[model samples]
Target: MTIPQAQREAAELLARLSGAAPVETHISAVYVGRDTAWKMKKAVALGFLDFTSLAERERFCRRELELNQPHAPGLYRDVVPLTRGPDGRLREGGDGPAVEWVLRMAPVPAGDFLDEIAAREGLPPRLLDAVADAVAAMHAAAPRAETDPPAAMAAILDGNVPSALRAGLDPGRVRAWAAAARAELARVAPALAARGAAGFVRRCHGDLHLGNFCLWEGRPTPFDALEFDEALARIDVGYDLAFLLMDLDLRLGRAAANRVLNRYVARGGDAGLLVGLPLWLSLRAMIRAHVEGTRGRDWSVLLTAAEAHLAPAATRLVAVGGLQGTGKSTLARALAPALGRCPGALVLRSDEIRKRRFGVAPEARLPAAAYAEGVSAAVHAEMFAMAATALAAGQAVVLDAVFLDPGHRAQAEAVARAAGVRFDGIWLEAPLEILRARLAARHGDASDANEAVLLRAAAVDPGAMAWHRVAADDGAAAAARSAIGMKGHSMC
Candidate 1:
């Protein structure tokens, strides 16, 4: 923890900027270097990060440039040879023998960093859209690697846990949380690895956070990626994107978090990437909590209660069954915003779940190849899992899907039973005329159902249901409220 002499000298030099520079408080030694900052590896020999020699630093610097140039094109200066002058001063270019090498960078504006701006404004919708777009672009541009992402992720958790404990957090509580997270990761590893094999894991900004992003000419720009380890940067895109999503949810509110996630998923056109979001967001929130606690920053005030904000409030989940284009998703959407009034209520739509499984947005028109028998099965499994997980964790999950098949209905009922929670099905019915009209006029919908799909779905049996019936032509809010009223509850 001792400040090295080199860092001390760098601090002194930074105070002597040529022109008037922005004044700041709590300036890091890393920031106080020459006008063009010199970034050396923090050394890798320590089993964590060892950059012992100039050669290693040069190698990692190239990796940094290779990984970040596309995203931070203007800021990452070229890797330059660092040499000492005749007067023993480290200079970029001077008549002296080379002593070391480092990656130089164009300094970012102090006030433009997203953390400073968002902390002040709490992440406006425009900024959220920009962040979502930036992340989607990064996911598209990042390269995939054939490596074990789980092992790499475990190492990060291991390092962070000890640091948190050392910083005076309750060790028992930390271990308990870590154990739960590890258990969930084990359950999902096969799915994650499968996605990775299918080209979802990629080179990412290993240390993505608000501080790592800044506004440059009205665009969100990312910089200062983890330069030392390719393993750190190579990860499932969901795990990578989860950092930002979870951070937003913790720092802002659920509504904004959901909006940003919707925007990101819409732009990326990948619904499969979202399956791991709940778990990843949970892990990310825990990581941020540990980091804040360890780094002497007060983040507890910003984070929601781990238990209260854990999942959408489901206290009791009720599955709603109906044909496609019969207003299933509309009812779910109306219920979701209202669920917000009750601590936490999140409606996990089957349409959205289906689109995500095929790696496309729900609104995107996909070919039949995208929904092969196997894909169909996978999508249903995901829907069941999402609802079960949320409901089990004490959140109300309104499953929005066409229950044309009895088996799908059975599986959902089984989840409700196993969770020991009350479950009900709200069946919606609309005449063929009503269905066609609704489908024809529907635009900007997240569901992929078309008039033909609805016509085909309308023929399936509604099956016996412990259900309440509602008409689709009636106002969705009124129907939804009526359904709740039938259960002796008030939607308002």
Candidate 2:
């Protein structure tokens, strides 16, 4: 709907009086009031429609406040009636009459914007923790939705493809990428379908990019959700989390994204969503690039920048290797976000992929059929293929594997060379006593190797890979910091 002339005039007046008000490019007009802000959607009919009638707008105004307030208390304000006198003059709470309704929102400080904070100074650990906690709480509080992920994705993907093609992009390449994305999604459809059935689906903040998040009183808050459709906002927790992962891949660290994932999983104790994250993240990035490009002229730069960042980031593959119980998984989890700090970095864990392929849980033992010579070869072959595919596309990749055999090491090196990305072999080894204690205390662990595997592998010469060893101790984090070239905290 086009913004009514009166609304536009009112917005201009509001902007003049308030310090925070500004005319946003995507929306028709936005302005700040004394304690809150307002956005008046243009009357233009795009792929998504807004309230057309005055009464409809009033209803939407109330719903926006109702929906956002529960999660973002002290952030959203009541939608107050805007009165226009009989003489056709509009004013806030005028005695004359009710002309329309404005969706009011509590004003937040400008410095609270995460993107602004990240651009100026890399995100602080405290903020990262806050954001993770906020989203976890949001997911926990949300009610489950009935729709499945694939069908929801299809509609969104269809809606986004046209805009991407229309942005004077290569249609053939876009089409090919879309096909690849769809195939990846299909591969994980069963897991996604189960999430939908198990009531993991909920009303989420559909667009969870950095810009929509802010810190108020030292806590991360999500605002301005997709109010138009319940299906868009209502989704699997993994889908909601994928937005942040994609955003992190686009800007901060892949290791950080991994850390975020691990923290969320540790809190919720659900890794079921792991398989769906990468595919969903890719789609989310693609859709965002398209939306920014098509929405307005000012957004062209955002589109170009996102295309450049995401095109390569979509491919980074990480190769991880360490003996069982030496903290290979822990270090890999830690390293993921660091590698992802650079755009186009993706970490593919062998454990997760292996479990997915063999129809076993991460902790389940593999059957003989699943680990026969041919089957083992096939698993590695597929993993290498995935790693290479992501890397060839200019993404930084981390592959987590035991690298027990010299042959596996060679294959991984060949992939790095073929893809022209630097390869780092990380060997995490602990003291014999530490390994013994770690293995002995394990209860229902995912790692197949126990004391026997550790004892055997410890004796077998880890000969050639000796140069890459990182000692596991209290200083383990320091070793990791050195491996990644991150400067240590300075004493002010």
Candidate 3:
């Protein structure tokens, strides 16, 4: 049968089964029923993929089930064969000769899709955090892949420029972006190689944008991962994450993007990933620009964003220090989103680092022994090292800790100085009674401090405080931003 004939038959069958028109994409059609949905790949041979043969379709149908089931088990049900009997009537599953294959999945509410949610009601901070957690968990469990990071990235750049030009984007802008991207790739090649050697390269969701996620079991679950191309999906985790970050920045706002970036890194993502973020973000935006342009949509904004990603931005270090419950973390989070680059600075919190040192979650409480002088010293050292690494990568750093020791505070300044970036320190101060009350009410926090711990910290005479002392109140973040010479409202 001709390809068009097969396509028509599949659509008719799905429509009959679903009792409604099917949703169509360039490559596939999905029929949504009351509780279930069936997806069938079209019998068309695109340059990147060809699903014209029944055998090929069956193989990819099973491949889709394998790739997505582990990530969203509740949504990806199974791959079933559409077979024909002796009478030549098509049925979903049987022992007859198979004509086509379909992937069955649990139907999700349209409003529950992340993109739909973003359009109807902006993504809340809590939901955004959950999205970060979900992506981080998937990355942590992904098996590492062997590939040349620099070469893989170079290939993407090579493919994108011509595609953008062909899709009717301005040739001048596309060419300019190509030159800047190549230069950036050359600059970060060594770092990318090192990240690959350190096993940061892995099999990741190639299309990790907001539209590829849905609310499943009351949590944001990623689905419809790019399953047809292994080379495209097997990539650096940082590159995989860039798609989501770029999407959030373009759709929601930079503040939302900043929250996800910080949360992902805090959940054990390598801070070194920031080294190539500019290039990765630009590449993702360029892809969207061309895809939209090809469809005759408004893609000028995306093209402009692609150029902006390569524009240089100044990096700096900002440290927020205070006793427990002085709201050092709160102020740090509030100030981080506007600090440096598009997604803002990386907030390195001592409490979170200490928890990581103990091989526990951020909110997991540690024993008293875990906070001994030696352990505390190690935590501070790691925090400073991470700050230096991020600074060297041209990403701003935010140190969140109680600088009870003057030496630690000095080291924070020294890291910035070594990186040749400006440094600013803000000391938060709050009433003793308020500190005790706040510490008492805290739960599920990274800091294990309590009333007793707060008292001990308060007793220490933090020796002639020299940093900008700001009152810990509702305006603390604004005051800190102003003190740091930043002229903008807080984004967090």
Candidate 4:
């Protein structure tokens, strides 16, 4: 790709200021200095975007700052000009006619970029949780958009094919994938429209992937939002999240992807969004396939991933029930990544539901009245309802709760039966001493139960337990997996 003369001059000017070479992409060049980085939009006319004019670049530079500043804070500073002084020398932020524009940002350490971190140490569970929290936070604050989601999706599908073919992908495969994707979109069109009306459509981070995230201020922060096109940036939050999910599935593994998905939902992402996840993931995979093809890289794996996203998967509901401190939530989370679809099961915990019911964070403590019999019943009911909703969407679900009341256990099974899916119940058990110690050590947990609650729960006979009884120990996950007949299955 030839560097246009104007962009070349701008890059050179930025390089001089930064004392480093510019990192070039198709549409922009970034020069990282000791304390700052300057990003200059290339003077080019790609079919999807046109930044050829100086005025247009300046406008987009400002737009980029405006879109990303709130999410990244001090990282996105301001848009400055590359000016031509009377001496005919190009200068950065000079008082002369502006020749080009650049977005200035705080310099991010190369190793802090999520993609580099993934490549080096791999994403740890804590970091993956943080990543999900960051995305959920962004979605919560995103401005709602009124665009027709179905039409927006259709337009994206239509735009992908020609570019994919032009990038030398197999024409037949591209067309077939497009056809299947369109069919899936048609099937879910009503759900998409309903979600749009409910305000799930928003101006989102248009290009959410590992490469665009970095550790800033010791937290995973998203940056470099797609700025050139408002149409691309405005989308369903689920679709925005899908890019990162797809990237994680491909780069890290399905387990990592599953962790992020469950964590995101736990942080208040709508479970209803699961209905369109397969289609969204397929589209994201296809985007990567063509982008890689264009860069003269092997895109076959990504193409295969695109096809796999639309493949049907078995769905079931698994219930993990036990008294407080038996580690039901732990086992449920461990088992969820292996169940059902790519990113795995949604774990609906009664504790988290109860917290949400009272408009509190998961770790917030509630008054005794909040856990009264009536409140507990309502929490169980909400958990079952959420499970049913997810199962109906062809997603697997794991219910995490203490089903001390036989009635609640029966209701859980009934929900699965109604959804026409298989159900497995695992009852975790532990000695009173062990349970007491576990409860006593709990901190910042959703469960408010302590030794007193544990002793009380222990005194109540969970009548005629018919579920698989597994010892609540380090091997609990393995025992639960075996009891569920998942011995040979590959975990996500």
Top TM-score prediction, candidate number: 3
Candidate 3 lDDT tens digits, 291-395: 999999989999998898888888999999999999988888888878777788899999999988887878888999999999999989899988988998888
TM-score, each model?
A: 0.64, 0.65, 0.97, 0.96
Q: In candidate 3, how many Å is residue 359 off?
A: 2.8
lDDT of all predictions, in order shown?
0.65, 0.66, 0.89, 0.90
Q: How many residue pairs clash in each candidate?
A: 15, 33, 0, 0
Give the C-alpha miss distance for residue 102 in model 1, angstroms. Answer: 4.4
What's the lDDT for candidate 2? Answer: 0.66
Ranking by lDDT: 4, 3, 2, 1
The TM-score of candidate 2 is 0.65
Find the number of clashing residue pairs for candidate 3.
0
Cα deviation of 246, candidate 2, in Å: 1.0
Assess candidate 3 and give its lDDT.
0.89
Q: Which stretches of candidate 3 lie over 4 Å from their true place?
A: 1-4, 490-492
How does residue 347 of candidate 4 score in lDDT? Answer: 89
Superposed model 1: Cα runs more than 4 Å off: 1-3, 7-47, 86-88, 100-102, 149-160, 297-492
Name the lDDT value of residue 216 in candidate 4: 98
Query: What's the TM for model 4?
Result: 0.96
Q: Which segments of candidate 4 are over 4 A away from where they belong? A: 489-492
- Model 4: per-residue lDDT, tens digit, 349-465? 888888888977677899989999999988888888888889988999999999998998899999999999999999999988888888888897889898878888888988988
Q: What tens-digit string does per-residue lDDT give for candidate 1 at 19-117?
A: 333233221124324456545443336564656665776677787777777788777777776566777766664556545555667766677889888
CA shift of 145, model 2, Å:
0.6
